[model samples]
Target chain A: MTAKKIHPGAPGLLFLALFLLLSLPISLRAGEALVSGQYLSAVGQDIKMQITVAGPAPGTLIVIQNLPIGTVIDTASPAFNQYDAGKGEVKWLLTHVSPGRYIVNLRLLSPLAPGGISGEIRYKNPANGRLINLPVRP
Target chain B: MDSEKPLAGGIPMVNIDGARIRRIREEKGLTQLYVATVVGVTTDTISRWENRRYPNIKKENALKLAEALEIQLADIIDHGPPTTPPTEAPSLLSGEPSKQEAPEPQPAGQEQAIPLEATAPPTAIRANHRLASRPVVLFGAFLLLTLSCLALFWWSTANDGENQVAAVRTLPAHATPGITFPVVIEVTTTSSRSFSLILKETLPPDCIPAQGKPQFVSQASDPPILKWIGKITGEHTVYCYLAKLRPEAKMDTVHQFTGGVTVRSDDNPSIPVSGTDSLQVSPFHWADSNSDGRIDDEELLSVYETYGGIEGLHFGKKLIEEIWASKGYRFNPETRSYEILQ
Candidate 1:
């Protein structure tokens, strides 16, 4: 049998395709997810909040960063999976979560000012390692 | 006569004596109704004239009044002096001159002299007589009526327990078992009276006060009476308890909470008012549909169906969601299960 005609650029074309596929942004491939945070009440000297997450967020890292001054996580209530007190960040790492909604309640103790305080929450996509920030209004 | 009073119709004004009419009518033994009939007017007109409520009357009516009194017109009129001949007055009334009188010619620019009051209608004279006597009496009558109304108001309000003290109680009409809700009591008083006020809220059997040792003197009595004893001067409000309804409370049945408030002032004691409010425990627990104290996927689906299949249930749909959240159950629509994350 005669040998099949060899295309010289076939291997090069295959390598270029592989490079493009690997370099594609993970966020472009993943479904969009949302994160919302609210400061609920002042319990004695402690502050309370209810945070919500909507969409399929499996293997995601949820971070609440840049908290208002003089505030820290309260041990009396539910504890976060990971927290960096120096960075003012509270992190929750979810593994093997299904496509659904989730909510978390956190109580923080702070020497709050007279009027009110504000903060933000960030959602880290495990696939592309992208951070989405959600503001927490007064 | 007060010059401030309006003048009678004449070059020289006069004040009519209302008492003279009463005296003359009495002397003639004439009833006001009879006189009014003769004058073609209501008895009230005659009464008003005698009372001096109307300062003036028409001269025609006055003449009729004199005839009804069986008196001459001049006798009824209190003219101080006649500047003109009385014969002229009669001539004016008869609308004719005396037959014996002859016309006299006067010098050029010399006019026949006649008093304007004599030529003017008696109606004009009556309108000019303008003082309303007995204003003091009218003012006294009005004052008496006003005082009577104020007394009546005071008596009615005091008798109805409105003038002294009033109290009201309010509570949520419906609540889920083991939920915490507010109970409010308000007391008001019209007078700033210093008194010892006691507010007693009788909670249901399984209810408990969420807060301890409130600002007021608090006490717990059997049948769960939460009592506050303090001295109040005017108005006060007592938000006694954020009461947590026990899970053991009877489901689907309304439970009544009664409240009694009493005020003892320096003048009055034992002013007590009582009111009642009720709360019904929801028939089914939201997350624990089977009362298993945990949310199963089936129960979650049932909740979704009941809430119109909307996710992130809110507004009218937040009742069950709030209860479940209170129990530390975060719903996962993907797996359709509620997980307790610490």
Candidate 2:
């Protein structure tokens, strides 16, 4: 059997094709993207999460989920997102939680783009106000 | 494209493509703030332009904003004819228009000028003002009426005449044949008026006023007194008159006093002749008939015929003692008589 000669330009062309293919779905979804999940734990501790995402629209909705076993939420706290009629985003504050690790998953309802969605959830020592990042479970 | 000139007498207009301007801004991802800053104005000004407020953004600022936002000036200003049809003008010569008649459209170019004169006369506008002035006038008239009434009342009370008459009172006279007891009188007057006191004595045939006239005593510090005496036992009325010197004022009045008394004489001469000069003592002896120590009918008749008559009698003390001693009686002062000694 004789080996066929590989053309240099052909490799570059294949890579370009893969790049366009990956970017096509993101470009088509030019609407708002929302990512959200919750934190869970046992008693006598707290969990905190910092969320950030970018999209073509001015606002995005994010929801944090899976609170700890003895966790309480404070709805009246100052952790609120400024709402603009032209853009839509909703922020919520989950507080007075217990100790434990949790897996927080995110979803985008009207995603503007791909690879811009990311968030971090932490197990915080409520007494000391320290942060510890929690790992996502498979 | 060349800008089209507006027709004479027609209001200037600007065409706006709101959707296109919004799309361009979105495509550039520029906020309204960024555009307003580039145009040297506020975000609100830009919003006003986009919203198409009447008499939209000043011509100069609008042009500047359009250049900065990179959009055609026409895209921010609406220039088409009004959506509603223009109202018909009113005819001044016509009779007052019915309520249904369309109100006159405001002068086209001067829409903002307020036609104060055409709306209503200033007086009509101030009808409420006339009503407001009435209370002041009414209050003033009420004050004047109250003052006049007070003045009339004061004048009437000030002119009332003073009291000039006096009060008169009477008292009793001495206890005599013709006299009464408690002889006194009081007279009170508010003015300086003179009074007269009169005392008249009416006597019986056998008697006369003791001194030909009644005595009069006047005291400036006390009431006056009038005294009279008579010899016979009969009733007599004494009268007094008080008259004010001011004849024009009816203040004269009269008063009267009255009393009565009796007197007797001692005489005895009449008698009948007896056969042996036994004195014809008829054995039916007269009891105190003489009102003297001895019983004598002739004396009794003589006294009755003399000093009018004795009202009653006070028998002589010596005769009462002699009678009681012969009867073996003792005198008892409490009974005013003699009783037989036990």
DockQ, every prediction? 0.01, 0.00
Off by over 4 Å in 2: A1-138, B1-15, B74-79, B82-342
Per-residue lDDT over B93-190 for candidate 2, one digit per residue giving the tens place of the 0 to 100 score: 23443333558777677967776645888887678557876897799899999999998886554332122222222321111121111121222323
Q: Give TM-scores of the second chain, every candidate.
A: 0.35, 0.19
lDDT tens digits by residue: candidate 1, B1-342: 231122244433222344578789887655676566456577666765665434245566676788777787555554333222221121232334433334776786556666566877887765653333357668889999999999999787556544466677655556556555555566776665464555667777877766522443444645676666555665654444567667667667788887655443223323344444777776333335565554433343333333322232231334443343334454443453345543
Candidate 1 residues lying further than 4 Å off, grouped into runs, are A1-138, B1-162, B212-218, B266-276, B283-342
lDDT of 2 at B159: 34
DockQ, 0 to 1 scale, candidate 2 = 0.00
The lDDT for every candidate, in the order shown, is 0.53, 0.34
